[model samples]
Target: MTANDRTKSTGSTDRTGSTSSAGTPGRPLTGRRPLAIVAAAAALAATALTATPAQARPAHASPPTALYTPPANPDAGRQILDLVRHRKLADAAGVLAMTATPQAVWYGGGTPDEVRASVRQTVVDAARHHALPVLALYDIPGRDCSQYSAGGAADTPQYEAWIDAVRAGIGSLPATVVLEPDSLALLPSDCGQDDARGSRTAERYTEIHYAVDALEPLAGTKVYLDAGHSGWHSVNDIVPRLLAGGVGDATGFFLNVSNYRSDSELAWYGKLISSCLSYVSAGGAAADCPNQWWAVNDAQAWLDAHVHAAPSAMKHFVTDTSRNGQGPWTPPSGVYSDPQDWCNPPGRGTGARPTLDTGDPLADAELWVKIPGESDGQCTRGTPGPNDPERGYQDPPAGKWFPQQALELVHNADPRLVP
Candidate 1:
């Protein structure tokens, strides 16, 4: 489905002030607290009761396959899996306890050594819990169109060196990297006013190639290049960008990183891009190609026809399930005060967490590329300071925190939060 076509669950809301709840008479519904707390508490109680029955059963009463085996990093997968599986919060939490870490941090903004040291500590801690630390790379030049999401590496050269240091931090450990979000699709031939740097298409490709080339060789590092989302660009438009930006060298591409595009849309978009890549490898030109807007019935049909299961043959795709439960909120007429509505638009809700298994051969894995707690930049309605509730600053743009955004996200996801 197109992003606009994806259905919004019954009680979803836009966090931005433009929308209000249906009931509760005049009070400008600030948030969705009462209902979310009730849901979570009920879920927790049900989860405890369900475990009692399971514990009484024989150790191997059910075949290993029938049992719900949590992942080695259950915390990383829980929220998303629970949402996907339609399980109550408590049950998902039970599975999550198996491998949840305290908090997480990304290494950027400091000297290479400092960044490396900090990241190494985080990685080491995650390894201790046998969890895969989710790392987000957000130091690309011209990040967030150089607005509030600005403040990346001073230059491309420094950015590359920073990437090198971050890689060293990972240091042959089990980790997943969501590389330079919005760096691919959001980049334009011209970024307003900052024309001096120009479009680093060639440089961008080199950096992406370098990151993939550097990380994938590591024993347990899985690096995914960020592909914006289904709404931003058509597969045909983006596939060439991927190829130009070193999709050939990376482990694969990631879709819906930090955006609210649905699984069906993501799967279809991913398959289309992958298929186009296949066609290109066989000498098809990206330009002059028709069928740019080819439609599919759903993700399954798209995958069956286009997904190449083998990672090496068909470059795989990973999707971000961070905050996309309800696709995107399109402003009525001219509701946006800022043109950058793409940055944390109001009324949006959290989506599933990141995952490695999508049950589709074409889809290599799904992941929470967007760190939930981190701000998508300053919102038009919220304040811009640190953790400012009015501004909604859960985590600094690219910093670190433990169990960040989960509580607030769960709150936001409640239908009661929506107008």
Candidate 2:
């Protein structure tokens, strides 16, 4: 299915009165007095004032020379704006703060010329502010196991043409392209979406390889392939896939793109994957490299004994802090046959702000690869009914603005999204 097809199938009106589309989307923090919450909300409202939208910058005024802030999807700011109009300043502040932070712009469906024009506009906009835009190229064939957010190019040829268009749109401009989330982690074979001949899986690899080759050589482009998250795909399992998909040719891999794994877990997972990739490149077997499940001391010790490459020599990675502040959710045991913990779990919050100055050597930067306020599709939580059993309401479809979850993310933001 293409993005339009998915949108047509699952499209519905979100709380903000917008039609849902194909995309990745997110919850809140915990204990606090009512007064403290109110005061923090006010502080956040004040902070939003300082985060001027990218377009507001004068043609020559140098904005923060950092991650590119794309134009707001109406859903992103609508909740905040509505709350502000209602004099719900506290709630408005939370939503404002969430939207104010820079997030990645996703492109999953378009004709070659259409995608080219769209991408060109984004890159040009970023160039105006001297910012590096994070572009997520998600139109791989057979994406998302045909589940929520299921959509991509119809086939390899079309996909390649789309990539060429993206490259043309980029045109030697600086950008960090997150190439095809889940393209590697959730292959067609993994979801039984492939045939006996495994043609789809082979094509999947070919497509990703093509994307890496197409985008990595750009003069100012840095491309990162997806590696799922710490919660899934051990270092051994993911390393081989990354290798197959040409991680060596790309900038590196990204972890927790649209999941809720904690920062500590993701960092350790990234380090292990980086170390293992280095070890493999040096003729060490991936199976021999310690995985994330190993005890910390033992894993480090294994790397010490088997991997001598400096951190600079290893593959670097970025993590999604978009909605990991509260980490992964744990549903009540024995309640649902499938928890769908990743799909719009309640009480999650935004993670660390996007930044390239990560102190870790092998970790390139932390990014909000997933938009913070969009829905992860309607999370049924194993029920036959439409409503999520846990939340008692039908969640918005993927890529739609989810106002309740947006507020939760604000309230629960780790490091506290306060003034």
Candidate 3:
């Protein structure tokens, strides 16, 4: 509900990694054979293509890099194990297909020493595989607006020490770090949790800036700040936050983490934000930037006329396609007082597989920022009862796996997970 709950559900939890032997850091880990076949098909297709005029839009500007694939979550593993025990080999294979794809490893709460040890082991394991790991760092103070996926450090100093431990664990390993998913979008001031003096909001920014400063400086770590998603913050609204949160120094910002925004929407929005960031850095006003709310042609025209920075000159972004295969869920009008659309909506499927080959210059990758099949917390839908009326059952907490949801994601996967 709060721009993709990054923390493990109220109490749920999830790991580390090392450098290249994995090929190149962040490269797609969908197996070398599959990649080769796809490349051959693409090459064959390219031979028959006709030339077209270059439009003023974001195009693939960088070669694709590799992304690490951490082990599947316990739920996925358990599901597979049970299926195997029952001789449900086909079903077991199907679930394996769902979990085999590259996804982020989330880390929310842990003691400094514990986190450091865990992260160190993770990076080391990644190094052994010759892959690059994606880390979802989500232990900020006042996280999740203190909702279902609540809990973070008690205060700023404690938060800083935790971050310091994370840095120590990462060391000089090649990694892609997605810093605090909702850190920017759901500030204390916006949640009515800040004081009259806005001390909490100020502290939030300070924490974010501290993280960017700390993690971005590591030789092999590329740190990305949170910018919510296309549906939440407009280019104008989030650009200033990114700037304030140290996007200038970090590896740009990430979009759609743990949310369900479509690929096309995310691409367009990311381009606009990247272009606007450039425009603002060049002395243009944030309000003057073209926004996603504008008509498509109008926005494109605005960009052509006002922004001139190359993709290489602007900050790059990544998107969460983890569970947006069917786009957003639209509950029946006037059904429940609150639809809780973002909270474990039914029939939603996994989107694109994690890949650095996004083909859009501004989009660095389409990542599974939210592990597939993880619950978004129990949804009451404004009812007094504990069960979600939509599902007629109590949903699992934020980070726990739901077997039904897992199969739903597989069955409805946009490109078909098992075929």
Q: List per-prediction Cα lDDT, in the order shown.
A: 0.52, 0.75, 0.73
lDDT for each residue of candidate 3 in 118-169, tens digit (9 for 90 to 100)? 7877766665555667888988898877876778889999999999999999
lDDT of 2: 0.75
Q: Which portions of model 3 show Cα errors greater than 4 Å? A: 1-65, 85-89
Over 250-309, each residue of candidate 1 has an lDDT whose tens digit, in order, gives: 777887665677677787777667777776776776553323255455534554555445
lDDT pick, better of 1 and 2: 2
1 or 2, which is superior by TM-score?
A: 2
RMSD, model 3, all Cα superposed?
11.3
Per-structure clash totals for the candidates: 19, 10, 14
Error of 2 at 344 (Å): 0.5
> What TM-score does prediction 1 earn?
0.65
Q: Estimate each model's TM-score.
A: 0.65, 0.86, 0.84
By lDDT, the best candidate is 2
Instruction: Output the better candidate (2/3) by lDDT.
Output: 2
